[model samples]
Target: MRVKDSATDPNAIAVDSPAGTASPRVAAPRTGGGTLLAALGVAAFSLTFPATVWALEGLGPWSVTTCRMVLAGLLAGACLLAGRVRPPARRHLLPLLTVAGGTVVGFPLLTTLALRTSSTSHAAVVVGLLPLTTAAYSAVRTRAGHSRTFWAAALTGAAVVIAFAVRESGGRPTTGDLFLFGALLVCAAGYSEGGRLARELPGWQVIAWALVLCLPVASAGAALSLRTEPVHLTGHAVAGLLWLAVGSQFVGLWIWYRGMAAIGVARASQLQLAQPLLTLVWSVLLLGERLGPAAPVAAVAVLVCIGVTQRTRS
Candidate 1:
């Protein structure tokens, strides 16, 4: 994530162009095109919480989570097979499992459960801390260093979300907040690891492999849950399920990992600073959730913090 200039940092991943040898203007492109890709990925991910809410209209929490994974896994499997991708080497298995456990199982299940009790707007703000958490994970795992300015900004962003949660919940966090915070932790770990892996492999391959690995378990869970969960299958519910499967889980991660590969993990993550605000707009427009005045203030505060981190991170 915080790749020291590849020239100086021996541990930094060498990013070669498609021809195997790359241009010297790596830094320029990373800041430009890479940032754009990450921004697009953020836009895609912003809809996830609202989509999950819509999905809950017709499906049980467990059913929605499992069904979402199953569908994404199938799509990922199709992509892999179409391209005749080779199986991952044994060395990649553990990290792949980590990715699958966190992104595929942990984040989705926890957030879905939380959505049962939480407003999408509230949930969006709570999960807004993800960029800071992800950058922290990337720093630790990669043993990269960030400037004090970067840490200060990141911590301020986190503090804003925490304070907002407390204020909203009458000085105490709710069950939904707890679930979302847990989702925050695991998802950060998965995202940082996936970003790291993306450097060595194609971005899509990383998410695809992780999703495919969980296909069997997800399918089984979905099948059993379908028997127990009441379902009405309204247009909103079906559309939400389709978007969650294809848009958020699969395509979004694919784009995100590619961005992480192009830029560093830390910088790409900062781009996610705007995600919560986007989700807020979606919650209002799509889900018709009302937001208190504090939500926008906190969202804008977090957005400002990311601006500092992007400029100061080194």
Candidate 2:
């Protein structure tokens, strides 16, 4: 979000090492390639809710959660071995653990739980505010400052999303909404930390190592869940599970971190302004899930906030 104009922005922060030392700052990519990468990442992520719902059709939420994590971790482990990537340094472990806890475990589990009750379109719109949440986290973690205008737009966006949530549930937030909000918060933390970590290591390495770090616990959870959960695998379910593990969790993350490293977190996050809309389209086209009229309105409003925040971030 530093917008590659780092020299003019005194509040810009370099991605920090765990030893409390700042690493080299990532420069903005000279071409549109970074934007393309980020856009692709957003595209991959937009299908997440639909895919989770598909997986849930045949697999229990617990099984969906743990199985995806296990599969992703093994995939990541293979990538590390194939590339002979070094184990992360001792100082990197804490942040890596944070990444694993937030993205690999917390976000996946929470969103899957949320999907149990929430329609894909509903969940997608609620998650539309993630970029703002992530930007706020990034600013706080890096001690970056934003103008009043930036904060105002962010707040308005949050308020709009909140009102939408209440309206969706007949004046109260649903359990699914609560779980989606939790997923939003945890996933934001994971993303901010991962983007920062990517500055010090390859983007692929950052996510790969984080996924690998979750292997022991994820594997155990998968085993336990599989034993108890009644999984009647169907085409949609198997396809959904594979996409969750490979597309969203691994390949998408790898692409996203690289783009974030190149374009900076806040700037790269701007691409996600389209994600909810994309997800909405997918919900209709792929899942035959219809959305309330308010969904598009809320999405457009949030998009405005993101646009304003992007302009005012400097």
> Which one wins on lDDT?
1
253, model 1: CA deviation in Å?
0.4
Give the TM-score comparing model 2 with the true structure, all chains together: 0.85
| Model 2 residue 223 lDDT score | 91
In candidate 1, which residue pairs get closer than 3 Å at backbone N, Cα or C atoms, i.e. clash? Answer: 1-265
Residue lDDT tens for model 1, 64-102: 999999999999999999999999867678888988988
Deviation from native of the Cα of residue 102 in model 2, angstroms: 0.8
Task: Give the C-alpha miss distance for residue 183 in model 2, angstroms.
Answer: 1.5
Question: On a 0 to 1 TM-score scale, where does candidate 1 land against the true structure?
Answer: 0.88
Question: Model 2, 108-222: lDDT tens per residue?
Answer: 8998998888776567645657877887788888776778887787777767766665565456445688888888898888888887777667778888999888889888988
Q: Give candidate 1 regions above 4 Å deviation.
A: 1-29, 164-172, 294-300
